[model samples]
Target: MTAKWREREKTGIRMGRRRRMDMILFNMVREELRGRVRRLKPDWNQLFDRANANKSDRWRCW
Candidate 1:
């Protein structure tokens, strides 16, 4: 492969990997938040309550 084309190919591969990683993390977060939605206390505000919780989502809510 020519040096310039090799560099472009590497860049494309890196970008594709990063995008896939981002999509996976985003989906995991979405499903976790869905669990929270089902069990959230009525008195708490969504943003504040999620932020102030002492445990991680997996531990406490999700």
Candidate 2:
């Protein structure tokens, strides 16, 4: 099987027609977010720290 199929199997992500379209839109938004982050050119370590902190807070809320 292809790598994409392998990844889907590992993640248990079964995408139907509607989900496929949603994924396409999600990817477009992700690309836009990446572009904006690249343009800012912030410190990588600082970004990592912030992300980690946010993730911790998110888990706490759960």
Candidate 3:
């Protein structure tokens, strides 16, 4: 094979490896975010519920 053909082949291999790494990293980040959201969702709901409860109490007082 010519030198240019060899170079192109090496470049293609490197790009394929990079794409696979990117996908792995992306999935890791996505799972981490999903876990965080799962943990935080209940806290978020509790906060919202408290805020609404307080608002209703104030309306009753007034």
Candidate 4:
């Protein structure tokens, strides 16, 4: 392979690995938060509460 093609392949591999790591970390954190909300007191879990259907319908609350 040409030097330029080899360099591009190396970069692509590195980027793929980084993307996978980011997705893994994101899923781990999301699961952790879900677990914490389930175990915590109701007051502490207000953000995750679904009491207000109207708030959820919007694209962005903030």
lDDT score of residue 32 within candidate 3: 60
Collision count of model 1 = 0
Show where candidate 2 strays beyond 4 Å: 1-15, 38-62
Clashing pairs in 2: none
Tens-digit lDDT track of model 2 for 1-62: 57765565545434453455456546755665686775765355654454456363222211
In order, the Cα lDDT scores of the candidates are 0.52, 0.49, 0.52, 0.50
Pick the winner on lDDT between candidates 2 and 3.
Answer: 3
TM-score quality measure for candidate 4: 0.38
Candidate 3 lDDT over 1-62, as tens digits, reads 57775676567557685465456546755666676775754354554454456463222211
Runs of candidate 4 with Cα error greater than 4 angstroms are 1-15, 38-62
Question: In each prediction, how many residue pairs overlap at the backbone (N, C-alpha, C within less than 3 A)?
Answer: 0, 0, 0, 0
Q: Could you give the C-alpha RMSD of every candidate to the true structure, in order shown?
A: 12.3, 9.8, 22.1, 13.6
lDDT of 2: 0.49
Candidate 4 lDDT at 20 equals: 59
Model 3 misplaced regions, further than 4 Å: 1-15, 38-62
Q: Which 10 successive residues of model 4 have the least lDDT summed?
A: 53-62
